[model samples]
Target: MTAPMISFEFFPPKTAEGLAKLRETRKQLALLNPKFFSVTFGAGGSTRDRTLETVLEIQSEGHEAAPHISGVSSSGEEIQGLLETYRNKGINRLVVLRGDLPSGEVSAGDFHYANELVSFIRQTTGDWFHIEVAAYPEFHPEARSPSADLMHFKNKIDAGANTAITQYFYNPDAYFRFMDQCQSAGINVPIVPGVMPIYNITQLARFSDVCGADIPRWLRLRLQDYGDDLASLRAFGLDVVTELCQKLLAGGAPGLHFYTLNQAGIISTIASHLNLQGD
Candidate 1:
């Protein structure tokens, strides 16, 4: 079989030091020859400028870069300005999201759902950008039901999303099952599996809670057992995640999109384990 697509994600840093570190992180990950690097827009469009700067820098480095654009807390005018800015910069890809409202924020702005944003992009820019939308294999926390979540995802695709990148989950079965459902629903676009390299149990738990990604009972307990011994935890976590990636690839996943957390050590190790460099 041909090599599957590989990609990495990073959040824009708010400090000069953080920005310098991300530059190094990107440098190391670039050796992996990722199809593209994605820079996240913060909640409520908080990191709008930073995200744009990061993506443009990545593009200047001679690599493809995708910037996430959230519409939940933005006006139609604001979103249009962003689109035009990216287009002027020669950015041809975007990861569009409904995004999260900032703390204590009310209104859903002009676009309430991701589909609305996707529709807006198509109507405004035609096929200029390759749009990517988020997917939830374990069902979105706010979703009314499994069917409801599926319907929402389909709506995004129908609205002209070119592809999807799912929220990270440790369970391969969840991903395969989601793929089955999507196929049944006639959603054939490539839905790349999101992979989060485990580094800390506490941090993982916090993220899982918010995103509704399940940490399987066995894995959770095992991770917790490691306690403060980070070395053992990392080794075990590496083995487990690598195995999960192996299963997904062997089962026909189109690609792996890693939430690198701005660190390259673990992800680079995982890529080496998978021979992702075609060695």
Candidate 2:
């Protein structure tokens, strides 16, 4: 059997302690030999410097670092400058996004959606970078409709996105249906499923709400049965994610991208189930 291609997403750290934790997380996950790793950008490019530093560190440690960029946070020139900085630092991949609006605020300006960011990256970099765009199996909260959301996705691909990494979902059917729609809409690029093992039910629920990923009643009931048993909860979460990965692989997913949440144990457990191990 062919080995599955795996990648991880991490957020930039904000303090000395957080940076140490981030580095430790990187070190642990790096043992799995991921295809690449991504660092998320904060709202309005707030974590710009930290994101760059983390990417550079990952590259220094012999890993591909794909930095996230938000079109809404930057003008063309500013975006160009950021790309140039990454290029100089030997980074050649980006996760282009139309990031969430800041709290208690409205619009950010310049670019409103991901397609514009894709277009801008292609125009500015000329195919020197591998660009990844976000996809929604359950639909984005701001999207007009499922069809409209897919139309926007197709626009991003047409603009030069090489792949679409979907938001995490509990149901494999949702991903399968989304892929069918993507194919019908002429998106032939790889659409990797993003998997987030539910560590904390409440926190995951909040995030799912923001990303429009539905938590099935069955899953909620299962977690509720575990109550305050941390060890049992962790085991159950790993098993659930592992089962999800197996189903996706069986259904022909190209690869898996983990939202690691700056931790490695859960991802390691899932990878073990997938028959992938650190060398």
Candidate 3:
């Protein structure tokens, strides 16, 4: 069987100690031969410099890097400069998003939506970069309605996204249904499943609440039952997430993109469970 093309998402490290730890984590995960290592961009470009440095470092280490970009607060010139930098460094992929407005900030900047940024990238870069946009199988929290969310997703593809990576989901049916809706809407690009390993129950709960990713009552209760038993929590979480990955692949999902949270053990464990760590 052909090996699956896997990728990992990481945020820019803020300190030298954090960067060192990330490098160590990257070294371990590199064994899986990931397609690319994507670094997250912060809201309002807060981590712009750190993101650039991290991506450049990844490239220096002989791995493909996809830097996230947001046009929500950047001008044409600013985005163009980023394009040039990525091109110079031979970075060919980008995870594009209309990032959240920082707290207490109002202006949506020069661009309002991800589709506009997709259009701008197409116009400026002219196919030089492979753009990846975000998709929400469970619907975006800010979307007015389900159909509206799907329409906006299709709009991003219509503008110029090469493919999409969905928000991490545990319910395989949700992804399948989302894909069916996309197909009906005439979107033919790959919609890779985003996988987030359940590492910290509290952190996961907070994130899921904000992003609208349901944790199912049963799973929530299970985690809550674990209480302070982190070892048991992690093992159970791994099994659950691994089972989710298996179902996604078996059901014909294109690929898996792990939101690694800069940790190697959990992702590596999940990878081993899927038999993806084998040569």
Q: Which candidate number maximizes lDDT?
A: 1
lDDT of 2 by residue, 85-196 (tens): 9888879999999987667657676898889988888888898999999999999988898889889889999999999899999999999999999988888999999999
TM-score of 1: 0.98
Q: Give the local distance difference test score of model 2.
A: 0.88
For each candidate in turn, the TM-score is 0.98, 0.96, 0.98
**lDDT scores of the candidates, listed in order:** 0.95, 0.88, 0.92
For candidate 1, list the clashing residue pairs, or say none.
none
Q: Give the worst 10-residue stretch by lDDT in candidate 2.
A: 270-279
* lDDT of candidate 3 over 148-257, digit per residue (tens): 99999999999999999999888999999999999999999999999999987899999999989989889999999999999999999999999999999899987799
Q: Model 3, poorest ten-residue lDDT window?
A: 270-279
lDDT of 3: 0.92
Summed backbone clashes in each candidate are 0, 0, 0
Residue 226 lDDT (model 3): 95
Q: Output the TM-score of candidate 3.
A: 0.98
Full candidate order by lDDT, most accurate first: 1, 3, 2
Q: Against the correct fold, how does model 2 do in TM-score?
A: 0.96
